[model samples]
Target chain A: MNTILSRFQIEYKPFRLDIELEFPNEGVTVIFGRSGSGKTTLLRCLAGLERSSTGYLRFGDQVWQDESQNKFVPVHNRPIGMVFQDARLFPHLTVRSNLNYGYRRIPPEHRKITFEQVVELMGLRPLLDRRPQRLSGGEQQRVAIGRALLTNPQLLLMDEPLASLDAQRKQEILPFLIRLRQEMKLPIVYVTHSLNEVLQLVDYLVLLEKGRNVASGPANAVMSRLDWPGKDWPSTFGAILTTTVADHETEFGLTRVQYRDQSLYIPEQPLAVGSPLRVHLLAQDISIALGKPETPTSVLNTLPATVLEIGPTDTPGSSVDLKLDVGEPILATITRKSLAHLQLKPGMRVYANVKAVKMVHEIEEY
Target chain B: MDPSIFDWQPVWITLKLAATTVSVLLLIGTPVAWWLAHTGSRARVWVEAVVALPLVLPPTVLGFYLLIALGANGVIGGPFQSVTGSSLAFSFAGLVIASTLYSLPFVVQPLQGAFEASGKTYLEAAWSLRASKWDAFLSVASPMAVRGYLTAIVLGFAHTLGEFGVVLMVGGNIPGKTKVVSIAIYDHVEALEYSHAHWLSGGLLLLSFMVLLIVYAFNRRLPVHLS
Candidate 1:
């Protein structure tokens, strides 16, 4: 598979970024970080917008920048598209013309993404003739994404495209973003500070802090580590399980999803049976039970989970995290007192009551 | 009061000077303004000061320097005289140069302010979309700065139309060639032709106000900056 290899070192006075890595050119590789962690700066460097960065950068087979041989492709010459935090639409042009700004410049032989495809994907059909200022913030961002897609770039870089939008607007645009990721199968290097975005969109994850890479790997592996910058993990920590809709109990307003060989009930979802769904269950949300509760408890889903491992997390000294083999590896956190009281240990069989599960808005490719 | 006594040559010369000055300023000012707006170099402050020198300096001071610079033996005028065997001082070309220099700030500052205000995000967006530098400027920067261009043109034209000290110093009142509306009005006042001076002076006043009014009105209708 084609991959992007890069080694970059940049300095902004007191802070410096020194990193070297290679990632496959597939799926969304999210650079997750906090504010001022040099996330945007790193994305800018990938786009050739940060000239001060010195090192070698190879996108697939193309040498975008190689300082050793004095080779550099300017931002305009690179086969990449970028969507900034704010929708930087050309104010003077109507939506159609703004979308066509880059489209008109590309040679026909190089046009891989069609205008019709982008317009449909971004839901921009209705706002074609309108000016950018007339559109709502969400509509403006949609056009920005569409404009970038119409370029048919080899790589797409997004720098907090949804950062400026309110939560509702973010929800409105995320579905379209997921569609692009699915339908186009485009390689995207996305930068975002929101953990919600990570839960919703990330495939490969790179964690950053103070301009340095903390950890990076497949999203699940990195997340399972439960280490975050300035975040209380194992509490905010969760597992993303790729499951299929098993069935729906309409009378009880619940949907059953099959994870591994076990099925769990979540609040009713509008999804077809046997379709794929991503279930996000927080470590804190699952409680341990010595046996399957004979009574119909308020907790709906109970699974007989085997304790795979038990360990005290380094950050939070009071709680112990349990890795359970519930047909799938799921993490559960409980206080140290509870662990002793229940005598929870590896190789022990126990029932787990799943208190909450969130259905994130994107399908997962497992 | 006598319509026949009024020579329209000065009116034509004034219009010609304003149009020529505006065109020249636009051509040269755009790149300079763009550079000022985007460059991080230490030379920016110095270049800005030189461009805005006319705004602070008296017109006659600018004219006095241009007088020497465009004279027969001066640096620029010396080369031209050797080739064409003619002088630039007191000619229409001399007035054009003086007017352009005087209105340099008017043209450049507005465009630079607009370019700086809108910032680099949009331009970077265009470039990432594969637009060349010139392509991005023409399609994105220039169009977004429409108000800046409008203000620059009107201010440059009007400021040149009201030219007096610089033209008087560099361009001697040669009828049908160097004589302009301001110089014509000055001549009427000196000759005690109060009525002739009144018509010309009032015309310029009203004309400047109308042009400025139109610009302000149009600008008010436009968004201060496109979001």
Candidate 2:
């Protein structure tokens, strides 16, 4: 669905968060940024909670805000569900009543998602009768999510939904959220700073820095770019590669993946053929090979690639990072001794001997 | 003890006067106190000073001015007499008016304290939730400030009940009409009837203490925080 998301440009006294962003209207569009990078402020502006914001905001056909026209829809009238970092469940309300409160507010004709389905989706059936004060942090956040979903909002805005939970609680609720994303026909704008969440869940990425749009595109494309804020190489920081499982080598404890007429192997993983997987390649683990060597090596994935770019090394003997454009972008870190030995140069064909293609996780496709 | 010597009419008149006075004070005081608490205007301090005038003013002086203003020959009372065919002074209604004036601070102070304790956040939260102004006030602000309303009621009623000098000065001792319990007790002592005075004093003491005890005990049992 070609749903039109707004371009937000807002300025407040002493601070300003100005960025242009287009939401996907489906799946999870993560506004990934560090804390204090104006992620929450941007979400609040979209929710109409920050009325003083001067900008144009439109979700599909509806106009939430237009400063020149002096038109601004208040928060209650906006058909957008917002889940805060802290859940913000009314302390005075029971879980069932809290869910019902929002449900009762929506017009009868617009109520597509039922209360029972929402409760089941969030796994909140047992805690329906309990008050918010009695639930654990994770359970409370789940109830908050269920409550928002039952409202049948046009879009859901989650501002760091898992930030408040500990590691164990985050693990507990993440699968439920993934299920919600897969099953529900809801478009979500999920804001987070955690790289793990960005790697696992995001389909569309809107990277913000200091109130400015840094990069925006599909998750894998944007995340695989070198020369990003901190790192000079994609793998030096983090690299997400899309690959499909080819076969499993059970005796050798290896799983094979086919990419560009090459069979690559990772540690034994539980995955099926045609299942997409994202491998995290560390730059330090990759060694460049100018010529194909006929010798036994412990390394698994070795693919022939053309050099795209190279950067200077920090130490005397350390090799520069060579940018290799493959099915997805990859980076190779080689020593100056190895670089001279292989005679590596830009646009020259070389082999990237990957020591390991760390099986990050199997990205469940929607 | 002795019904004839006791003059039960004065005791009954006093109860009626206190009840009427407390009701009038509450009706007038609530809105005024609410405004004082909510308004950011510099004039609030001036209004507050006026409300607290009874606390510092000598009862006889206040009573004298009220008497002149409502007396048969005075400017307001003369016009009032021509319109209503009755003077304001020396009447049961006059006793209520005087008692209300003396008890204004007791009602207003407690109400102000209660309102301040309730805070503005509760009202704002309700407003954001799409509750109409009236709905917000009824459902949120009023319930949040309930302790203040209770305190206002109790203080206003008790202060009116105990009024003596102001009521006597404005409301001449008309035995069956204007003579309240305080005036009745004073009359008993002036006539050397200690038994009748003792009975009225003991009854008022018991009633005031009971109201106070109820207020404190009920407040203690409330789950929500109180002022």
Candidate 3:
């Protein structure tokens, strides 16, 4: 697979960052970390906003920075668009002119996206004549995104674009972001701390802590790993499955989703049959059983599975997580007593019962 | 004395001098102020102090130094005189040079403050949008610093218009050439021509007040986000 490689080392007075990683040149790559974890700093380095003395970055065939060669492309010369946390729209220019600011800079023959298309995609047509201050926070961010898109950049870097908004405003802007993700082919490197955002938007994940990358891979694969740092382990320890709506039972108020060869039942969703959906199954919500139950079980779904791995839980001495391969990796936490009772071991055939399933609804398109 | 009998030559010369000085200051001070606002070099403190020197020094002290610098025997004036076969001292060109130096801080300080307040955030945004450094400054920084430009123009022009010591020292009382309103008023008061002094002084007072009033009022109507 084609990928972008980055290697950076930064030493400021109180902070030092050293990371080297590669991510696919398509889909959303989330640089996920808590505040002060240097996620934003990493994005800045990629954008050429913060220069590191010892750094090398190459995106596909283009070389952005190579300190040893004394080659550093200035920020303006890079074909990358950036959306800052504050939306950083020019206050002196109207929203129309602000969008035009970047659009007019690129030569016309090289431009890929038109002004009208960007305005339509960002829902900024109504706000064209208004100045930035006159728009709401969500509106300003939409304009910021439109301005970036109109630049026809090969890559877009968004540094916590929703960090400054209130919860309601975030809700207001999330749909637009999802549309951008779905409609545009531009590769985006998004830095966010919101778990909801990660689950909904991230395809590739890079976990950063204390200026270092601890893990980086496909979002679902990295999230299912039990060895992630303790602080983020609980929040990120879940499995993500992409399923499609197979059928709906209106009388029973159930939506049957097809995952691999098995059918999983969820609460009735207002979606057309055959539409794709993402399901997040938390490890703590699953249970294991030695044999299939007779009938009339309260648990909504059950599947035959084989134990893939057994690892100690984040909270030691109490429970262990059984990574079961029910066609895909599904995690189930059980007590030491249950583990011994079932004689659970890797490669052991068993039945896995899911007590609950959460449909990640934000990513669904109407 | 009748108003018609008052010499209007000084008024015209003062206006001309102030306009020319302000134009030159804008051209030179803009880049200096921009550099001062964005630079982190060790020499920034020294440069800032030098720009502010004229603000604290007495006008007569600055006039004394300018007189030596522009005189035919001094470094700058010697080469200028030899090249042109004309003395720089006691000339309108000498006054322009002196006034530009005397009013340097008036232009630079406001611009520096504006540029600093405009901040790097917007410039970075512009850069990420493919704006070259010069393009970003012209389209984003300059427009946002409109208040600073206005303040600089008004202060520089008014301050040069009221000049006495610097002009007197460099351009010694040449009518229709270097005899500006301030120096002419001084000459009238020294000669006990009290009515002429009062008329020119009153006219200057009204002009300065009106210029400031217009700026303040127009500034209030500008969008607050620009500030």
TM-score of each: 0.92, 0.71, 0.94
Candidate 2 clashes: the total is: 1
Give the runs in model 1 whose Cα sits over 4 Å from its true position.
Answer: A226-236, A288-298, A302-309, A312-316, A325-328, A337-352, A360-366, B217-227
lDDT of 3 by residue, A1-366 (tens): 478898999887588889998999999999988787889999999999999898998989888899999999999999998999999999888999999999899999978899988888888889999989999999999999999999999999999999898878887787788778888998999998765655667889898988899889888777777666636535336687778899999899999999888889988887689877677787877888888888778887777889988887456577887787876676777797888887888999888788877765343221
**Between candidates 1 and 2, the lDDT winner:** 1
Clashing pairs in 1: none
Top-down lDDT ranking: 3, 1, 2
Error of 3 at A230 (Å): 5.8
The DockQ score of candidate 2 comes to: 0.19
Candidate 3: regions farther than 4 A off: A230-236, A245-258, A261-275, A313-315, A359-366, B224-227
Compare candidates 1 and 3 on lDDT and give the better one. 3
Separate clash counts for every candidate: 0, 1, 0
Candidate 1 lDDT by residue in tens digits, A1-366: 398887889998888888776887889999988787888888888899986446788998889889988888999999888899988988778999999988888899888888888898999999999989899888999999999988888899998998898878887898888778778878999998776764656788887778877778877666655333334222335577777899999999999999878788888988799867777877888899999888778887777889988865465478877888676667888888899899887999998888887776332311
Q: Alpha carbon lDDT of residue A105, candidate 2?
A: 68
Pairing residues by index, what is the TM-score of model 2? 0.71
**Model 3 vs truth, CA RMSD:** 3.0
Maximum-lDDT candidate: 3
